[model samples]
Target chain A: MKLSRAVVIVSTCCLLAAAARADEAPLEGQVLVLSAASTTDAVDALRAAFVKTHPQVTVDAGFAASSALAQQIAAGAPADVYLSANERWADFLDEKGLVARRRDLLSNRLVVVVADDSKLEVKRPADLEQQGIDHVALADPTSVPAGIYARQALAELGLWQDLEAKVVSAADVRQAMQLVVSGAAEAAIVYASDAATSDRVRVAVELDESLSEPIRYPVVLLNRGAERPAAVAFYDYLLSAEAADVFRRYGFLVMADDHPAADAVPVAAAQRWWGLSRDEWLALRLSFQVGLCAVVASLPVAIAAGYVLARWQSRAKWVLELVVNLPLVLPPVVTGLLLLFVFSPKGPIGGALAGTLGIEIVFTWLGAAIASAVVSFPLMVRAIRLAFQAVDPRLEMVARSLGAGRADAFFSVTLPLARSGVLAGCVLAFARSLGEFGATIMVAGNIVGETQTIPLAIFSAGNRPGFEAEVWRLASISIVLAALALVASEWLERRHATREST
Target chain B: MNRLSFRCAHRFAGGFALDAAFETDAQVTALFGPSGSGKTSILYMIAGLLRPREGAIALGKQIWLDTRRGIDTRPERRRVGFVLQDHLLFPHLSVERNLTYGLRRRRGENSAIEASRVIEVLELGDLLARYPRNLSGGEKQRVALGRSLLSGPQLLLMDEPLAALDAPLKDRVLSYLERVVEEWHVPTIYVSHNASEVRRLAERVIMLERGRVVHSGSADELLLEGYSPSGDWEA
Candidate 1:
């Protein structure tokens, strides 16, 4: 049933492929080409070619894991085309009748890769089951297209059962390959196209064609393209012989030169504040979760630090201050790198946690929250310390004279006096945590549903070839949330100021 | 006789040395001294809020401090109530809560002062809900006195508690203080530099100069104009 659809799409593309450049003047506006992650280089190459003939047209290409790209299209993200790595995701949008045009453009081969220094030998699919072979990283098979294809290939070879226990599922094909690079997994099975991009690993074995399912890249023009003529011209250009040659240069087999929303979404977009794609909504929701967890987790420690800094009289007080403020002064990326070293599987802290406690932090939502808490902790401590300082020590002395214990005096009198400042500190910390990116990415890898916070989503969406629209959507959500938190913090501080006068 | 006996050598920083030794059993013994003459310092030491370098302070049956024995009791456990010049009423609490704060502490432990009795004595029924921030200087001092008295302390130290009030307010609060002493019969050490205050309040006065007690006499004799700084009494 899918074979018929590809054939019809090719014949349709061939008819307009030549005529697409006949009048280049009409292709002056932007043409968005949305594709899977593996096709970034190839898509760039095609855009370069198309620009030589139609220099007036701008082709914005975005790339991501196929399923994520498909969900974006289904959520009515404004884009001109969809160039996907597998048939299922395209079929997903097709079922929703989102496809205005569809075609098969390319095919890819799968290979098993191992680190360059490893002694482990996997000459065939069956060789992956050796005794020393620990984890085999693969993109999540239940959902990710690459994992789905890898599963088919392994099941055909009868190798899936033996390796199932050793599988450490990655979020995407690139991440699967990265697992081997970091020595977290002994081997990873990824597309030959992705394998060519990295030099740290060698393709130990390429699975035979008969054992693997036929890998196909499909391209679709969504209903949003009807608004832009340049988008349709670019869609036709993708199926041209010129685009096929560029695909081959990127190590993708040139089958058809295989490759791999806007108007309908305007009503939802009109809502402005409430309008959000599912992924954007999730990003907002996850940001709040991470922010709240981060603040809640660090509050006790922050309060203790605040009290000590405010009241403790010791020579080492300056040292404590410096240590609390260290994260604020250090570059966030440096902080992330330091966290990665401690939390990575081979690193001291992460190794013990994973082995002894069965707690996994790397590439998980918990790790993201911890990273956020660390960065926002200093601000909380500083504000709380100021609040503590504002309270008169004599009040506590009077409380003590009234037969109140130190702890009782603190809770009843001191803490209540400083409540406004402490509340303002919490709001500021939450807002800062929501925007945290560098430290978060260092400790928690960007896994869309699990660890990808608002900043992470904005970063990846902006970098993706055609997902610029998604970037704006995520960015706007971040801005709105942060602004609200600031307003709340400001209101609390004003209350504190007014309290001081009375 | 009921008494407070204490001896402290206040060789504090900045070369300020106080060699003080006193034993008083009078109904009211005023710590009469100018500023920086260690009057409030003695009151704080008795209250257990401040520690002296070397001292043994015992109020009748209880030993409040014995630095030689390493028995410096915590202020909260010492059963000593202090009302400083500023009143020092907890600004965050209402008059009722402040009054009951110490009363709550002594609960179920054979407490002497009752919260309702304190409320009636201080006339704080209308001011129960009002915070210290909203109270006048005299009202605050009354509340502070009420709070301390309600704690059922063995020793009550007033370090010029009415000094911040105006003339009329000071007289009014002073009468209340006199009534408290007459009614509760708590051992009171009222610190005052004013001659009129010493005459009006203290039955006995101990004059202090340069951290030394120079005179021990009735308030009337101490207030005589011919009372000299060159002491006739040994300090």
Candidate 2:
């Protein structure tokens, strides 16, 4: 079905090009091509080579996550061409007639990767089924193309049904690789291109190419009526022997050059908030709940740590502060692994709770919240610490003089004075939780509508060929959410300030 | 009648020591001294806010502090009122709330001063609902006085209470103090550098210099005519 769609797309692109060439000659002028950061290296090399050969035209390239780039395009941003990591996005533009023509540039393979120095042996793809080796990282299959391929591969192997309890879905293929490379997970199924970017990890088993749809990278010229000659030229240059060699070096499988279909999305597709499907939205809602829970749960601890670090006269205060902020410095995957090591069923806390209290955290939403909280905890403490420090000690002293005891003084004076900082910390925690990827994936095992957040949704969306639009949609929503959170924090801080003064 | 007596010895580093011993049966006894003369320190020790190395403080038949037995009490349990040099009024609470705090904490006590009587005694009726930020220095000090009185303390310790106010404002508060001491007859140890206050308010004067008591006598005798450097009773 996908092959037939590609054929139709290629024929449509060819027809469009022929008609354009007959009417207005070949496109000409300076070109701007925006692409996903994953393709940054490939696109950069291609741009340099293209610009060197054609001195009259210059190619200005912009790189971001595919969803971000696609949103910029849909917003009618000044971009001549957009080359995405998957065909779904290009197909979206084609359906909207936003693209003059779409073309399949390259193909990618999905494979299971592990840390090069990993102790667990995975001689066969089915070895991922081992029970003790619980953590299996993958991109969210709904939104990210890599995640889709990984899920498809899992389903094909009949592993998806049994592996549901073990699967940890990262926000993106990069994060999935991080999970395995950091020893947080036993294995991660990612694109070969992604695995090539890291030295710490190596591909363990190549996913059966026939099991899942081919990972096709498609390029679309977005300026249809006012065709960007430079953009079209850059697109053509991608098909040249030189650019193809660079793409090949990046582990992309070169496909026969072909035009793209005019109508890319079939009927009966679910509408999304950016790239997230209904299930992914449920994941997002769950992510929000988890993030909020993490922040709220950690708030008292953060505030206490902030107070002690800010005001306590103990000799060990500095050491405590450093310990509190350690999560900020360590990589998130490391934090996740640390959490897993301590919270897994056999881990101390895990064993104690499960054995004594029967409260299991492994592969649970609560576990995911804990992972996100650990990573985001430092942010809350830092923010709250600053807030606590800014409080005038005189206020507490005055409360004491007015017959209030220490705790009463704190509640009456110190807490109110630091309200803005607390609010700012909570906002930061919320935003960080919404976007949390690595730690959450490791602890929660991306069960759809269970632990996945907006970032995970976008990451999963990026894996499918035709899900680029969905990824872009999710990306747009995430950006909006993050922006809204920041603005709200600033507003809250100002409001608190005014109230305190009044 | 409440009578407070302190025979206290406190040591500072490098051999400096504050050796003070005095007894006050009067309604107001002034500890007159310049800054760093251990006047505030004595008040703090008397209020049980500070622990002196060697001291004995007795209020009437009650032995509040005794170095020999090591029976010191925490500030909250001590029945003493302390007004600091600056009015340390609770900024968040209204004047009435601040005045009522200690009273409420000592809940179910029959001897506790009624909140209404405190408001009337300190002339804090109009300022009751107002927050500390809205109150002037004189007003705050009066409220502080009211709050202290409401706690039903045996003795009141005023540590340079008018130091932060200007002369005119100080006079206004000092006049109010005279009225309160005369009408309520609250036993008091008032610390101040102004000699005239010693003459007008305190019948007995405890003079301190460099953390040591130099003299103790009637206020009139210390500020005696021809005894001053100018040999004149200016006031």
Clashes of each: 10, 25
**Whole-model Cα lDDT of every candidate shown, in order:** 0.78, 0.72
Instruction: Give a tens-digit lDDT track for model 2, residues A440-460.
Output: 655554444444567766665
lDDT of 1 by residue, A196-258 (tens): 655567889987766666888988988878567888889988888877766766667767422
Q: Can you give the TM-score per candidate against the true fold?
A: 0.64, 0.60
| Model 2 bad stretches (over 4 Å) | A1-276, A383-405, A416-420, A491-502, B5-23, B50-70, B110-112, B224-235
Candidate 2 i-RMS (Å)? 3.7
Tell me the TM-score of model 2.
Answer: 0.60
Q: After aligning candidate 1 to the native by TM-score, how far in Å is the CA of A68 from where it should be?
A: 20
Name the candidate that leads on lDDT. 1
